[model samples]
Target chain A: MKPTRVTNTIRALRFAHDEMTQADLAERIGVTRQTVIAIEQGRYSPSLEMAFRIARVFGVRLDDVFQYPDSEEVAP
Target chain B: MSKILYLGEAVVTHEEKRAWIMLVVSVIAYAGYVAVVLGRQDGGSLTAVPYVGALLWTVGGAMVASIVAEIVMGMANPRASRVKDVRDREIGRLGDHVGQAFVIIGAVSAMLMAMAEWDWFWIANVIYLCFVLSAVIGSLAKVIVYRRGVPQW
Candidate 1:
């Protein structure tokens, strides 16, 4: 069965980080604000590189910002 | 200031009335043209006239419409054609991908038809089908990508 799922608080985290605008994060990571919006809303799952970039921007590990609610996800 | 370039606001530059007028005129013209082609005294050959006329008329009309619309829009706002956003880029990319698929599918089908001794009429139909299908599928993909928040493709 597909388990009940949940999403992240990247938007909240960004706000906590001095109210960073989507444009600011997008510019830092060479994407667009629309892409940033998509990610924060869980409508898009970013590529590994993009996830790392977002983590770097937040000055934290990737897991600190994003996590799948299920416990069976692969670890690298 | 590091060379501040002003971004133009999004607004409907081309008047809807002008656009609708152009639309109706083009539709009437094309329909009249097709009717004339179909009503010939000799009732000319389907291969010789109707199909060719359609391919010519539809494409010619579309080109004319695009040019007219672009000109009208540009008249209202010089930068009406510029789209400097990620959503626009993704939509265009989605179109390009669908178009590529159409070309590949058409070419393969044409080659198979050629091997079976199909003639030039078949090739012409194949080309027309390629273009029509490409446009339809491309537009559909664009809508899908845009509403669904970006496509993996």
Candidate 2:
């Protein structure tokens, strides 16, 4: 199977949300700020619940914020 | 900050009791070991009494610290450390990797030293340095794994 890396527009989304800090985002999602950071840096991919929580924060569809390496197929 | 996301606090549990315990025990053991090693020098002062005590103290300290850590973690969250977490497993994995690296380096260095006309100091340093580096790297690896999650084995 493929080792799919998480790719996200979280930085852009945060900026659009009135320059919300990583701390702000993490608090809203009920996880640590470091977790938000790891997610943004692609060092960590959050749980599905966390992903949805993040998407909801930016008021965007999950796909809008998070993209798979392959545009057509499901993530590995 | 927004409650939905950045609760803002990253409160890793306080293992102060265990930490302090380890700190005192470790310091004393290290001091004892150093004293014994130094006493055996050319300007030797003490007898072999300190050497025996140092060995016992170091081994005892390590064993006690391990148990204390386990107990403290168990108290903090019985479920959390029920089995090895992603963090511990990752740390162990990295420790194993670094340990293997040190073993290879030590073997090569010792072989080279055996063939060459060098003092025991060089060979001793090689052996000591590998052991220390493996431990330090292993400890740092634990911190990294805890900070950054590892889902896969």
Candidate 3:
């Protein structure tokens, strides 16, 4: 199966937001630090609810946090 | 304070390490049981062998070893830092499902052996082997899943 096309701005956002550590973000999002690392590295994709939760932790909209390159290409 | 330096970078996540411990404990326990049983067997039918004591000892020992290993791992890592998240849950379920398949197979085989009037020793050993296979295979699956990213589905 093709790899997940989902990507996120978690690393950049974390840096922009007071240089937040991965553990700090994980604690805020109620997930393990390793999970945060995986998401940052694009090895795992979070569920929609988790995606919204992550974005909420950073005080951003869902789209601002995650992107789908395939969806973008399909857009008219 | 001096900076800590290691010869090589060895990094294993807490879950992965737990899986490894379980795999090792199960294999060692099962091997020990088999060795003792075979060593005690005289020039007689396998059905005459006394296997109950060995089976019980191995089962209990494996349980204790697994518990002790988990405790040691917990002590080594800070409790607050050890977290089980979505990926961990998914991997656990996947491993459990794979292991459970062996359990059903073993049960059916034991039932058939019993119907055929096979030796009680064989039936009991088959059941014990199934349990061990479940644990070893399940732990192995978990370790592999942790190493290789969880299936996309």
- Estimate every model's Cα lDDT from 0 to 1: 0.61, 0.60, 0.81
Better of 1 and 2 by lDDT: 1
> How displaced is residue B152 in candidate 2, in Å?
14
Candidate 1 vs 2: which has more DockQ: 1
Candidate 2, residues B30-84, lDDT tens digits: the string is: 5666665676655654332235455555657666866877677667666331322
| DockQ-based class of model 1 | incorrect
Candidate 1 local lDDT, B1-153, one digit each (tens): 211121233422122223344445445545665565566526556445545666577768766876777677667777443424444565567667876788788888889988888876677768656765665566566555544555443
Show pairs that collide, candidate 3: none
Candidate 1 residue-wise lDDT, A1-76, digit = tens:
1111235677777778877766677678876555566676665567678788888999988888888775776879
Candidate No. with top DockQ:
3
Model 1 root mean square deviation, Cα atoms: 8.0
Give the share of true interchain contacts found in each model: 0.11, 0.07, 0.25
In order, what is each prediction's RMSD in angstroms? 8.0, 9.0, 4.7
In model 1, which residue pairs have backbone atoms overlapping below 3 Å?
A: none
What's model 2's lDDT at B135?
50
lDDT of 3 by residue, B1-153 (tens): 211211121245577777899899999999999898888887777778889999999999889999999888778765535567887787789889988988998899999999999999999999889988998999999888766556675
Q: Name the weakest run of 10 consecutive residues (lDDT summed) in model 2 chain B.
A: B79-88
Cα TM-score of candidate 2: 0.47
Candidate 2 wrongly placed segments (more than 4 Å): A1-37, A45-76, B5-32, B39-42, B45-53, B76-91, B106-129, B144-153
lDDT value for candidate 2?
0.60
